[model samples]
Target: MPLHHYLIVAAALFCTGLAIAITKRHFIGILLGIELMLNAVNINLVAFSRHDPEKLSGQLFALFVIVVAAAEVTVALAIILRVYGRYNTVDPDEVNDLKK
Candidate 1:
C-alpha cells in the first residue's frame, strides 16, 4: 500500500477519535477515544518509517509512544476506578469537585 493510503486512514481514525473524545460523557468512552487517537498516530509513524531503510527513528518513536500510552492508560484507569468508587459514577461531568 502507498503512504498516502495510510495517511488517509490515520487521518480518518484521528478525526473519529477526536469526535468521540469531544462527544462522549463517560470516562471509559473518553479513554477509548484517546487510545484510538494514539493508535492512529502509531499508524502514521510506522507508515512514514517504512520507506527509510537506513534509520528506524519513526518506528522507534512509535514504540516509545506505545509504551507511554500503556502507562498512561494504566494510571488513568486507576484514577477512574478511584473516582467511580468515591462518587459512584463514571460520568466526568457529574464529578465536579474532589471534596465529599
Candidate 2:
C-alpha cells in the first residue's frame, strides 16, 4: 500500500475525532474521541516506521504514546467518576463549579 493512503486515513480519523471531541457534551464521549485521535496517530507512526531503514523511532514513539494514553484515560476516568458522584452528571459544559 502507498504512504498517501495511510496518511489520508489518518487525516480522516483525526478530523472525525476532533469534531467529536468538540461537539460531544458527555465526558465519556469526549474521551472516546480522544482515544480515536490517539489511535489515528498510532496508525501514522506505524506506517512511517514501516519505511524506516534504521532505528524504528516512529514505532517506539507510538508505543510511548499508547502508554501515556492509557495512563491519561485511567486518570481522566477517575476524575470523571468523582465528578459524576458529586454533580450526578458528566456534561463538561454544565460543570461550572470552577466559577465559584
Candidate 3:
C-alpha cells in the first residue's frame, strides 16, 4: 500500500478516537479512546519510518509509545479500580464530587 493510504487511515483513527474520548463519560470508554489514538499515532510513525533505509527511528518510537501506553493503562486502571471501590461507579461525570 501507499504511504498516503496509511496516513489517511491514521487520520481516521485519530479523529474517531478524539471523538470518543471527548464524548464518552465512562472511564473505560475514555481509556479505549486513548488507546485508539495511540495506535493511530503508531501507524503514522511506522508508515513514515518505512521510507528511511538507514534508520529505524519511527518503528523504535512506536515501540516506545506502546510501552508508555501500557504503563499508562496500568496506572490509570489501578486508579480507576481504587476509585470504583470507594465510589461504586466508573462514570467520570458522576464521580466529580470527590468530597465523599
Best by TM-score: 1
Tens-place lDDT digits, model 3, residues 52-87: 757899999999999999999999999999999999
lDDT of 1 at 6: 94
Error (Å) of candidate 2 at residue 46 is 0.8
Q: Which residue pairs collide in model 3, if any?
A: none
Position 52, candidate 1: lDDT: 74
Better of 1 and 2 by lDDT: 1
Q: How well does each candidate superpose onto the true structure, as a TM-score?
A: 0.97, 0.93, 0.96
Task: Give the least accurate 10-residue stretch of model 2, judged by summed lDDT.
Answer: 91-100
Query: Model 1: per-residue lDDT, tens digit, 1-100?
Result: 8789999999999999999999999999999999999999999999999977678998999999999999999999999999999999999999999798
**Clashing residue pairs, backbone N/CA/C < 3 A, model 1:** none
Candidate 3 — what's its lDDT?
Answer: 0.94
Error of 1 at 26 (Å): 0.5
Return model 2's CA RMSD, one decimal: 1.4
Give the better candidate number (1 or 3) by TM-score: 1
Model 2 misses residue 35 by how many Å? Answer: 0.8
- Prediction 3 TM-score vs. true: 0.96
Write candidate 2's Cα lDDT for 67-99 as tens digits. 999999999999999898888889998898763
lDDT of 1: 0.94
Task: Give candidate 2 regions above 4 Å deviation.
Answer: none
